[model samples]
Target: MTCKRALTAYPELLSRTVAAPSWVMPGTVRDNAIFLSGEVDEVGLCFFETAACLAYGENDLPEHLADLPLGWHVHLPGDLPWCDGGAEAAVPALRLMDKVAFLGAHRAVLHPPVGFADGAARLVAFVRAWEAAGRNPEDLCLENIRGEDLTGLWRTLCDLGCKVCLDMGHVLSYGQYGLLSLPGLSGRTSMLHANAPGPGGRHLSLDTLDGAGCGVGRAMCALLPDDAVVMVEVFDWEGVRRSLPLLETWFAAQR
Candidate 1:
């Protein structure tokens, strides 16, 4: 079945960092806002990199963002190893969530740490901390990462009453390794990180979808509810531009 959902573009679309030997200047939040003003329905901000900008008294840009008519979403930093750092990690995430709440963001996408041995317990503690702080658990979305055994992680999130941010590219990568069976997870999904997966887990433009990636993308779109949000998660302007049409076509076909 086809569902109607809001489409958003990642901030990387306005500007992104290039690798060594290449000097490509990234755009500021203001520049990005101006570029995407009339382009999409919402913008996905990377909190890991922009948290400093939202610190006390640095509200000029965020104030402008609040004035915009578009929706807002936050992507938490993946660098914080919640599983290993215990309270240390959870604290920062909580702080960021506070900022997300302040911005009135619809949701915040989060990633489980890389080597989370005690994933379940760690997540429980983290969620408890979030709850104690009076943050809305529904606004926190746990995303599936590459090469991780997300089954237990998913269960932990579900138990805590949190939602999911299904990253299509990561799912496709997992499927490649025969680890892609998530039966009831989609029902709890509130957002989607839309992108096509390439070799070595690279995020590619939706227009670059190979046969398998295309099928996965279509399946995801079909599964999401009408109120779900889809963020084009590619990292460059060209990729975002190319992916938008493909996403529109997919959404149209769904109807």
Candidate 2:
């Protein structure tokens, strides 16, 4: 019963702040892909500081990533709160979505704001905007944050015909109250932010998972459809290198 899934690496593996090599500049997506060449199935493009690329009238994959065989998935900017300013707040994410579509991304993972007063309405409006722009709702996946009650948000997603990006570290850190164990949640998951919880609440390499954490990750993987995407959301190459084998071993055991 082994499932075949796409394995992706987060672009932050090129972050200079994480002690990246002297040649690798922080936030350079192309260099990051070059560094990760031949090591992953796909690349997770983080749109945190690349607004220029998403500027109006620009629509193409960055030069560095243009020729790579690895497929692209998007991590929308973390600060955009679609529920705050209505469509204006959502414009950045929507613009990024256009680029995502232009670049042929598998999915765009978004982090919705927690505790917004009009969360559901804002989400509906946002989805309407997506529809208005002729974008496919299936390309969007909402991720769970650390401390929010995403029940209403999940409902909104289901209503909009969208899917979920389940972050394993977030589940372990904030989902102990039972969301992970709930029925049907796993069935809707289209992506997994496959990382383990480490000191100071950071995402550790997958190989560092304790027995219980490993079991949780393994169970989560078992629930995903074979074509789902699993992004190793770690910050360093060592972590990425260590994680690939752990995930491979888990997938191998599933057979």
Candidate whose lDDT is highest = 2
Measured on C-alpha atoms, candidate 2 has an lDDT of 0.65
lDDT to native, each model = 0.63, 0.65
lDDT of 1: 0.63
Query: TM-score for model 2?
Result: 0.80
* 1-255: candidate 2 lDDT, tens digit per residue: 211122333232221011111112254566676565455556687675446547624222454455665667778777775545556656887777666564566467877666678777777777777677777777778788865545657777887887788888988877643656555776677787888888797778888888988888887777766667777788776776677666766666666
lDDT of 1 by residue, 1-255 (tens): 111121334332222111110001166655565455555556677665434534634432456666655567777777675645555666777666566555576567877666657767777777777778777778788888865646767666777888877788887767632324566765787887788888776678888887777877877776776667777777676676677666665666665
- Model 2 per-residue lDDT at 83: 41
Give each model a TM-score.
Answer: 0.79, 0.80
Report clashes for each candidate as comma-separated counts: 0, 0
